[model samples]
Target: MKKLQRIFIYTFLSLAAIVSIFPFLWMLVSITNKSVDVTQGRLLPGTHLIENMKTLFATVDIVPALINSAIIAIITTILTLLLASLAGYGFEIHRSRGKDIVFTILLLSMMIPFAAIMVPLYRMFGSISDTAPFIGIDSLGAVILPTATTAFFIFFFRQNTKMFPKDLVEAGRIDGLSEIGVFFRIYMPTMKTTYAAAAIISFMNSWNNYLWPLVILQSPEKRTIPLLISNLGSSYSPDYGVIMSAIVIATLPTALVFFLMQKHFVAGMMGSVKG
Candidate 1:
């Protein structure tokens, strides 16, 4: 019976691994095949890799889109780390009704689907040029402004902050440190794992974000990788080889970020557990 159970568990794990990895393998194989061969489900790689890359570059301004994606992801990450950490620390340390209510409202905002509010958000941003000064339509600000206050990050930070030691806050206070100083010096330093986890998650989300940017960004120069991929997929009779190459390009950075930060991700959860 135990042997049968062991065999069953192994079989399940193998199946799951194959299911997860098959799509990426297929994508790689498709990249190496002619468009017709890929569409026909030729599971093996062909010698069309270089040709696919050439076609992709010829058809799309992938480099500029990559730059735009980088700018958005980097800025979003920094801003999210600063703002969300501040808010999280404030809510956890203050112990006030007002702050509690505000945090609840922020969490509630996360529950509201972005799709439902997307049109209204789009119109508000579109009129920014005429209605607001400096930040107008078609600017990077258009992409950055809407996402600056991330509700999910707020919740993540706040939950993680609950794990922080109040004794440290008291110690810092005794040393004549202000609340802000305690946060920046005492709390932030010890929460490196939390920050790493948040940074990875925020960076990936911003980097991969599509629908909002699709609605807000107007020019090809400002479009993100996902948007670029979408356009590539929509072209008249898209060459699967070229599309696969583009997917590979679009996926690499996020994969790298995830791999580098995975240890921190686990560490962050452990911090939360220790709280």
Candidate 2:
């Protein structure tokens, strides 16, 4: 019976691994195949990889899109880390009824689907130049602003802050450090793992964010990778090779971020457990 159970578990794990990895393998295979070959599900690499890249670049100005994505992702990640971390620290450390209610409200706000608020959010950013009441209408700022404060990130930071040693806070106070100084110098440094995990997550989300950006970034010149990839997919005569190549390119940064931050992510969660 135990042998059977072991076999079953191993089979399940193998299946799961295959299921997870097959798409990426298919994508890689497709990247090196011609458009028609890819569409026909050829599992072998072709010599069209270079041609496909050339076709993609010729079809869309991918350099600009890549730049736009990088700018939005980097700025959004930084803002999210700073604001969310501060808010999280405050919620955990300050202990006030009003703030608790506000935090709970923010938590509840997450349940409201972005689709439901899409109209208002879009309008809030405004449509044309000088007509919008709020800032960031029809610009990269618009792309970065909506996602600047990720709720889950804020929640993650708050939960991590709960593990923060109050003794450290008091110690800082005794050493003549202001609250802001303690947060910047002490709490921030000590929570490196959590910050790393959050940074990777936030960057990936901002990088891959599609729906809002799709709706907001109307100009072809302002397109991001996701938008560019979508554009490639929707071409009148779609080039599967080119699309797959774009997918690979689009996926690399997120993959790199996860790889670089995986250790820190583990450390952060472990620290959270200890806290």
lDDT of 2 by residue, 82-199 (tens): 9999999999988799999999989887788988988888887775447642345558987788789866777889888887899999999999999999999999999987888888
Model 1 lDDT tens row, 1-275: 99999999999999999999999999989999999999898999899999999988887899999999999889988999999889888888887998888888888887788899988887787677787733566777778877878777777788888878899999999999998899889999999878988888777889989988888888788889999999988889888898899999999987776677778766644543354
The 10 consecutive residues of candidate 1 with the worst lDDT sum are 266-275
Query: Top lDDT: which candidate number?
Result: 1
Clashes of each: 0, 0
Clashing pairs in 1: none
TM-score of each: 0.90, 0.90
Q: What's the residue-level lDDT of 169 in candidate 1? A: 98
Give lDDT: candidate 1, residue 242.
Answer: 87
